[model samples]
Target: MFKINNLSVKFIILIILFASLIFGCTNNKINQIEDLRKNNNELNKTDTSSSPTKLTPKNTIIDLENTDSEERLLNNIFSSVAPSVVHINITKEMDVPSNQNIPDSFGFNFGIPDEPEQYFERGEGSGFVYDKEGHIVTNYHVVENAEVLEVSFIDGLTVKAKYIGGDPDSDLAVIKVLSDPSILYPVQLGNSDNTFIGQRAITIGNPFGQTWSLTAGVVSAVGRTMRSGNSAFSIPEMIQTDAAINPGNSGGPLLNSNGEVLGVNTMILSQSRSSSGVGFAVPVNIVKMVVPNIIANGTYIYPWLGVTLSNISLDIIDAMNLDLKQRGALIINVFDDSPAANSGLRDSQKNIEVSGGTITIGGDIVVSINETEVQTSDDVISYLVKYTQPKDTIVLKVLRDNTIIPIEVILDPRPGK
Candidate 1:
């Protein structure tokens, strides 16, 4: 039994020694593999450092430097113009119909009569300082029927404002801020004529009651005509932009890249009543003509030709038996006892049916005014709005009876001036 135990112990010791030898060999192999990998990596690094071949990246990298600079530029513009912009809040008094006769299901009055309720409605818009004299320019609709006007600045300074005057024809109004002159910073107005499409447009206003918001876009178009809600005439030479103009953006400044006021943001064309990227502004040129007159007098008097004009159309040309290449403003009707009537300007004498519809014939086609060719009614209207004033004499070249004739007419103040 002693001899067998010694043999078993010897066998176990041999097994243990064999296992250790196998493990040691496996570990040495792993270490050698690791060393080879390390050497390979070192050789690659040395080659890369000494190599002259420039490795081009497989992925395209966009440089965001210009984008970063653009953001900074917009931020700078907002900072500089925020002080000049103002938030306008108006309280309008309205008469609500009294519910005096509260009728029961049996159709009999069940309540006593009460007086008409006076409702005070709150509204908000935007404007900018016009001059050091505290005159602030805004839309006419913003202050229309406003019983109380409150203006707020960037520093949260709220002050009462008195409506100096408003030209509903141009949809422009001026209100005198009842605040200290130190808080007023008048904005620089740019020439709307110089504003071109694709140029950067920036708008700073209180959109959706969020005071002093900024929106940036490009001028989509120029020389657009917008109809005034309170005037018979349309505001001409408007600037159209794609900036996100909402309800409270009306009367704000649509600025150029130079931080100059290109126009006053007036309206947006949207079915949702929110911004759909289409917006219009009353051009600064019109503001230039109308604002000073509003400050000097009680209103801005617009020049009137006292004739209803329409663009020359194919149907009208066919009906009037005119040349197909003819293009001008067609006088549809002349107002009685007005400038066009006093100067013997002819109107349509008869109606003739055409393929499209009926058109009036025998009216005078205005080919030119003041030596400038009139291709459309807009041309005539734009010319008068920009160049002529009330009582200014203008010569019109009219095509009548297959012959061109010159007529002199003195302009008069538009109705409701």
Candidate 2:
């Protein structure tokens, strides 16, 4: 109804065109947003099976493969050797003074004790099956004076055992059980002479009365000698290990990584009555030597050198005016009509006190026997026990009066054999 100018009409047409263009753009944007939301919903509803699924890389398999080999070896060794190990319990009868105070007729206080009372002392140790004939090998001290011997297996079965024979010099003893041969597992004896330091050493025994406990270590040394049992004799060719062996671990097998018996765990050097990382084992080679003789006879006959020898110490070197590096067994005394006496080996004329200690002087020093060097008294004993027999002739290298002389000696059976 209102009159309009040409310029005004043009302005109104411009505004309407601008509005239409803006509305069209806004509607296009809304449609695009709706399409985007629909696409998102379709993506959310899609099944995982419709496409290949992405998986995280698994590294556990590789980790397991890397660790399985060593673990398997240890497991297999333990499984194979544990069955041959046994627990030994011994009961000994001891006489102890009775605590009862014998009162006078008036019941007056008196400190006089009653007669000695008998009591039972019990000990525990370890052993291994030696053969299929039910022979169990253990330390002689374990069964020494044992009134009752009992052997227990890993399966909790126990039986009374009888002492077959024992050699106190080697601290080894054999006992027999009446078990069936099919149930026994004899240990495989290894060549202890071939053992080397740093090789894996494993021990299975009843440590602190815990049955069939396993410990692992490395062989610390070989060819060691230690005093065994109550005897003054020394067990030679001992294997030294850092394995944790305690009171009940004696006579158990010291096994190599291949599960072969290298030695018999005998004693530990410790002040705490526990394992202090220094444990000794009797070499299987020595065991092999003594066990055969024990089985053949009721006892093992030890080969003797018929001379009392002492290791050449610094005191001896100073007193005797010998070479500083001279290491050998010094002959203290030779038995009458013995091998050393008959072979012209001279004994020490006198004992002289030196700054270090008292040493025997003017003795024939045994440097070697049959080309084998004698570095210590133990070395001489070890060589004789391992190599020589009765009635065998051995050539001795004697160092006397600054001269090296070869003396031939014929060995004889040890006296009182």
> What would the TM-scores of all predictions be?
0.81, 0.78
Write candidate 1's Cα lDDT for 214-234 as tens digits: 999999999887788777889
**Model 2 misplaced regions, further than 4 Å:** 1-68, 97-117, 415-417
Count of clashing pairs, candidate 2? 0
Clashes of 1: 0
Across 1-417, the per-residue lDDT of candidate 2 in tens digits comes to 988999999999999999999999999999999999999999789586786655647432223345677677777888899989999999999977655565788978666544547779999999999999999999998898899999999877899999889888889999999998988999999999999999999999999999999999999999887889658678888999998999999989999989999999999999998999999999999999999777778578776668988888878887888999999999998989888888788999788876766667788999999999888888888888898888889999999889999999888877666
RMSD of each: 9.1, 13.2
What value does the lDDT take at residue 270 in candidate 1? Answer: 91
lDDT of 1 at 141: 93
Top of the candidates by TM-score: 1
